[model samples]
Target: MNLERLKQEFNSKKKSILGALASGTDASPKGSVDKQIIPIMELLNSCPDAVTTSSCSGRVSVFLEGRKQSSTTSAPKQEHGADVAAAGGKGGDGRWLFVTHDHLSDDILQEGQDDAIFLDMVFGGIPSEPAAPRLLGQLSSETRYIHFKFEPMILHVLTETLDVANRLLTCAISSSFRESGIVSPLKNPVVAIRTMGLAFDSPVGVYDPERNMIQRFIEPSGLKLLARLTNDRFRENSIRIDSFYRNLLSTMEAPETPLESKQTRALRKKVEGINKGRGIAATRENRVEIQDPLEDGIPFLEDDM
Candidate 1:
């Protein structure tokens, strides 16, 4: 379709999706946009050329895979849009045991307990350990496994035209979303903003139905370390997201100039330094209060411009 027609369609779709979000009827598993990414989503949707289709503001999760099925037995169906793909299990049905977009709380950790017990608490299940191994003939029909995962932020956006998509992708990559790219170029162009470098996943344990327990592999200390690292990645993800927002805003305001030009980069660095000195990180909650020249009325000289 032509650019004008594409823009029209995108605008219409944007309105419908935004309306669904407001009404809490969006099809995402969470049923609404994450609060942390709301400002970014709003900013993109405000532009006539772009709208976000899906997004996750990053999360740490414990997932339980469905039971493995025999060749003759078909896998069970998944309900509630359970994220089987994210679990990477053979079974198509898997569910999240525990999930949070924010850093894990310290209360989840307890001294002198096995990681299995901690995981049980996290999943809101009674802590238990396997009492005895099943005999060969008494073995359960299927095996179930659980995993711990920390995923970085990911967003998919549809732009009215390829040029607009490219500009957005540039902003994403510059903000450390190295895996961001144009998913579709010829028609209905979609850009995926993401980074796999910060993703973390590890096998937690296997579940024994007979024993009603999870047998964990990692130690308690190991679990604590994982939580710490996941929280660190969360902070970095937030910083990058803020940078992407600023870069996009600059691109929108100065459409004729390259955002990465030496002068523009220097100006950006100066602004960042000022914010850092003031102990300010541009988060969605505080973005409106930030006084960047780009957002303020301050004008740039011809050379800086």
Candidate 2:
């Protein structure tokens, strides 16, 4: 393959994307790119052998799960779309509820007054004693809080060579996002790296858009803390991601490779002589020492007999 030509093609497209981004015409989803992450993007795309396909720096969000969208409802729908949340578009498949890059708000939860019809329908017309306290109490088991997600940003990359792919994977795992980074499948032609971490799955609230009922059992202060903590974790992960890529670029460009063993060198030298056009890597003289692609990270193509 003409590797240099392929890289040139990648660069051309990369340039167009960057131009769009700088001119505020980037087609990438809102929230997918933030100013804080621009440095990492530029750092990666600047590499002669690497290109960033997509990336994010992570964010905090508040979401309420509503009943399945009815084909009949004419209300506007908000989505997982960050811009939707920002625009206060509350009707999506379910609204994104709330989203932010920084822990900018101390008030994340909205105060909800009790709903009479909901209490009667689900609680037999008996309000829990002392309406002043215990917002929804055990009715949380009935018409209650659901789950909210706390997610970190993720990034994907394409490297010009398999060796660079493997090295990037190694660097990612060695860094803080160990469980986060994953190598692409052998069939894939590109390398992908991402950041993954804990997400809270506890049911916090629920919404019945049809009934216009929303009941939250958690305190407003608690929600504020959750948002703050989410931002904290996201910022930390962002730093780690930046460091991982910087370290990868610097160390990879000028790697300190270990000296190969004499026996290993001789074996590779012998194998290099074989015509790789055949799946077999050895001749009759070296029949006992053919290398396997899976073991050595080499790709094995099917024979074209």
Candidate 3:
């Protein structure tokens, strides 16, 4: 019943994983392996394929060890000692193993079974897609554990994406933002999709590895900022969607406005600052700050990405 203990355990393990990856202690040469672990743990815990056996070589051995019992059963004992490395060794044939605390000590590992379940719920409960039908269902399930407002969380992710994309677009339109500034604002899509955790730069692409389809927004500007945002605009559309759900829990709670009206307002704002008829803001006194991460990164080049 102690939420604090559960939270502490989750935070500690999460930090440990992130630290291990960042420090190169637990990272794979391909990268994002650490990023993948949280979601994998979540999925397995959520809909566990009981005593599941999986192997890239087409056959796998399952290991179950814990506090309540002492046992070791190995079938196909010939490959019992298969190389279990986080990633490939120089031989380029390393197998991944998923181990739980069950095998260690009964008192500790038994107590940790609930922890694994909790971890599964936390990770598996993340909203991975912007357009999936199950997203609303997931949000409803998530509210049982965390105190987060679903509407805000939805906005947070969408706006974060939009902010990154917008920033990229802005940079592309102007010459102010640098190349390094173009680094991915959001990191791995899987973690964000699965756990709604803070996203960081991953060598991986925008979508989660488990999902083959591209996420909802495909615009170049949207990809860059899909992970970071500090404004309310990101959730504006989601808020409208939330309102239709009759959830009745709103922060800004603005009544839904027409899209044409919104676009007109935005265009008016742009034209108000135009130099003569050109719609570009030209304030010589206000120079763009290069260090501001929120600033757009898309270079104003003649060609588009």
What is the Cα-based TM-score of model 2?
0.57
Q: Flag regions of model 1 displaced more than 4 Å.
A: 71-87, 90-93, 110-117, 130-142, 255-305
Q: lDDT per residue, candidate 3, 1-305, as tens digits?
A: 25455445444544554456457563223243322123323332232111101101011111111111112435454244343212112111321222211112323223324443432332233322334555344332111111111111111111113232332222212221122122233321111111112112221111232453222322222322222221222233233323322211121132452111333334334423332223232334354323323332222121111
Q: Lowest-scoring 10 consecutive residues by lDDT in candidate 2?
A: 296-305
For lDDT, the strongest prediction is: 1
Model 1: clashing residue pairs? none
Model 3 / residue 264 / CA error / Å: 3.6
Task: Give the lowest summed-lDDT range of ten residues in model 3.
Answer: 50-59
- Candidate order by TM-score, decreasing, is 1, 2, 3
**lDDT tens per residue, model 2, 236-291:** 77678677756655554553422123333343343333424333544545664534
Q: What lDDT does each candidate get?
A: 0.67, 0.49, 0.25
Cα deviation of 262, candidate 1, in Å: 7.5
Worst 10 residues of 1 by lDDT: 296-305
Residues 1-305, candidate 1, lDDT per residue (tens digit)? 78778778878887887787777786766766788888889888887778888889999988777755443443564333243333355335667777888987666654664676675655548354432444334345455666778999888888777667666666776777776666556665788888777898887667665666766665567767788888899999899889887877776677464334434455446544554554455453465343442342221111100
* Candidate 1: Cα lDDT at 219: 59
What is the TM-score (0 to 1) of candidate 3?
Answer: 0.18
